[model samples]
Target: MKQILKNSPPTRGIDHLAFVTDDLPATMGFYTKVLQMKLVHVRRVPFEMDRGQPPYDNLRHYFFDMGHDQLLAFFEYPQGLDKQNRDLPGGMQHVAFYVPPEKFDDLIENVKAQNVNVIGPVALGGRFWSAYFYDPNGIRLELATTRLSTPGGIVESVYQSEEEARKELETLFDDPETVDYWLSQMPLKHQ
Candidate 1:
């Protein structure tokens, strides 16, 4: 019987997820104090002409241990860049961190205790549940969890019936054939 993660993603997983921050100290404090992530490293991004660096020399790049061998990193620019609307076309809507089901409730309480307004452990189909909140940088975040009983783990937990998937996908396509084709592309839910 499989416990979980039976099928690894093609890229394994993200090495790090990066974002920009205005205040390095405050961002560090919030992530460490609120989320209990540890500060792992701080680098200085050098100004390289046309190299896609943040247009500055020795700007701060901080990394936090986001667990599972992954890092959550932030780059701090001098005087910083202005905040942009998250709803803008190129903006990130949100990022969700995986939380074990056992820890979900306590984490939510801790977030609220820190005076952060959180939305919910809202049901998001199948066993998916998440509580949404924002960091001090206004980066929308979620603590996501799932209740798993199947041997297939997370994959099995999120598995949907072919018929249900078809019904949901149909709305986005012009014809049933297109829907069917895309449906065939969905990763197989292993037994």
Candidate 2:
């Protein structure tokens, strides 16, 4: 049985997702041609009226409409710009884009044509699959497709209220057997 907590703010879904790219044209090319996301807007940050500072300069900005009113945005900075890699162990990890289960393989093939380093179609438990690739800026991205959530099938954890999930986690404290099982299920990097 499941229980619901009172007074939790419901998610209203994504507004936008952003990334920094060294090669703006190439990055835009991949999202447009491969993933089929459409370019819907472009703009630069206005840094006008600064006191004794360098004149306001524009950055190359582009936004893609990733459907459901969500935008995927990228900012192109010149080479040797500040960067961070999200691949460190226990790092702030990957971003996932959902796709129809049937098109998942074709999506992989399309992205592969761009010659990006990618891995998987890996199992994320039964009936769901994920593929991983790194963007030009070394940010890992995932394309996940699931057929696992159909009615009367094995229930998978996809959405859980934080408090409810936390309560379940609280039971793991000092329980060696449960802790061991939980630890074993984590990816190798987290072990």
Candidate 3:
């Protein structure tokens, strides 16, 4: 059995994530038009030519606010990178962003208007609702809102205490005698 130690809280979350793209302008247009992410910043990294250069290099960087302090960034090299299938296994999974419950309805409507296949503002219980869609580059994304209780307690079972959960599991479908026998078969640590 593992020894017990205090649990530490997670530190500050993501500031941004960067992806390399072949066509910078097309990608920017898609994010702005479909996703409604604003173009927050753009800059170029100058290549230093020996002494007192006249022309700055052409490498470019772009940033978009994906809400919160979270960001979506892209880099455009003069000779661009390959476009990889983001949906492949071990490839880019989906990105989910939090939304206010009130805004979820509007967000759902906006995303659908983009003609993208949007699935569910389906309430997972509580006040949470989540909608899923694919971005222009075929990257799957989820927009979600936390409602009354967190979503999991509604869609998925949740236990306030492990002991309570364990007791409930033990009593679920069995008589006392079968429960006792089954409990004996479980590992001591799990028990």
Candidate 4:
């Protein structure tokens, strides 16, 4: 753990997550209208399909503000959807955005008002709540909120000693009682 941490490059929050879109207008409308993200920038750049192929002169790149200085960007390219390997078991699965707990329910309703189905308020080991839905581009999106005590709360103690931390993590799944405690704390949606 120590060695891995030492070699890890320092990173701030994600600058943006980029996706490809076949219909730029609908993508722009869904993000800006339904999701309420601001359309911050747009530009066109030359794109090369292959080393030998002629460069495509008009690939449109656009950015949508996902708040807190984060961006969700899209590139409009011909046949971009067809070029993706949709059958891959583990490609880019989903993108999750954090929301304040107080505003979580309102956001869910807002998404529903836009005629999108949402599937959660599911508790993640009592540490957080997350709801999942798909964007107009069929990209899975998650809205999440951290509980009062987050999973990271134990990080300092857990990582205090490398060997001890490793041993605890390794055996963590073996304790059913601890797991039950976490599950028991999950918020009841109906209540």
Candidate 5:
């Protein structure tokens, strides 16, 4: 509602989401062995280049294939940083990865077999359900899947139905017309 800006047309999905990890072996193990993500790339960044990168040239940055060609990356910083609190503004609380429903239970069992405690298959208010756990980096992660079967797959599974969204939005918006306007812009109807 703030601006009538156009959405980016050429862009696709996320390329990567970078996180900080102190232990590369443990992080790599959990991601590769437990979660089954492949380690695709690893390198040291040159400090003089990429001005926004960590100041040290020896910093190790590595990537894991987080499915659909998206990379999940991590940086092993030398020192002098505190553990981040997800409650802080602009911090990530958790990341949820989509799992096909067929693979959901097996993934959860595999995680638990590796001694990771999980807290779901909880209903996320739509067809989507999830199991939450922590990585070696202490990053909360969720493996989510849908109970509803459809060709749209993960995207369709998580999308809110008009009735479900309107019910929640009604409590927040004082104007029904505003909700209707946004709902019109949303692709809530199934194809």
Candidate 6:
């Protein structure tokens, strides 16, 4: 008998997701030429050195339009990928970009034409479809399109009242095993 808050925080959508890249030119070429994402901006910024590392002059920061006001951005440093921790698998595993249903097939073909292997236009229990591929920087990327309706396509029920929704969410964390599995997946600092 918990009640959902009526005044939820205001948020639009993702602004951008940024990553470090070794070669800026090649990364830009792959995104713009292969993935067809438009290169929106490029800027030179002062490099921020890590503790115990000497300061470098500058780094290149660039962005690509992922449509729907979202962006995929990159940073190129002087030491390149070496600036990242090669010993630990601590960075992003992959990124999934949403593509409209109409354009999904064509985009898959475009990726294949670039000589990159495309994994699937596979269905996710009929809720959505996705295709996977890797970028020039070996970053696994996915393009997906939702097949769901405007609301409750995948949810078992659409709560009519805030109290109903809150009641359901209250029991969501009851499974200790599920919680433990998620916690275990977090990258260890010294691993």
* Best candidate according to TM-score: 1
Error of 5 at 21 (Å): 0.7
Model 5: lDDT of residue 183? 72
Q: Candidate 2: global Cα-lDDT?
A: 0.70
Candidate 2 residue spans exceeding 4 A from truth: 1-10, 48-56, 88-92, 149-168, 171-191
Error of 2 at 73 (Å): 0.4
Q: Please, what are the lDDT tens digits per residue for candidate 5 over residues 126-175?
A: 67688999998789999988887563655545567799778888988989
Off by over 4 Å in 6: 1-8, 48-56, 79-90, 148-191
Q: Report the poorest 10 consecutive residues by lDDT, candidate 1.
A: 1-10
- Best model per lDDT: 5
Residue by residue across 139-158, what tens digits does model 1's lDDT show?
A: 99999898655424655566
lDDT per residue for candidate 3 within 49-100, as digits (tens), equals: 7755323366677999987778898766444335567668868887877776
lDDT agreement with native, every candidate: 0.83, 0.70, 0.68, 0.71, 0.83, 0.70
By TM-score, how accurate is candidate 3?
0.60
Candidate 4 accuracy as TM-score: 0.69
Report how far residue 188 has shifted in candidate 6, in Å: 33
- Candidates ranked by TM-score, best first? 1, 5, 4, 2, 6, 3
Expressed as tens digits, the lDDT of each residue in 131-165 for candidate 2 is 99876667788998875656222223344444444
Better of 1 and 3 by lDDT: 1
- Model 3 scores worst on lDDT over the 10 consecutive residues at 153-162
- Could you tell me how far off, in angstroms, the CA of residue 152 lies in candidate 3 after the best superposition? 12
lDDT value, residue 94 of candidate 1: 94
Score candidate 1 by TM-score against the native.
0.86
Q: Candidate 6 has what TM-score?
A: 0.67
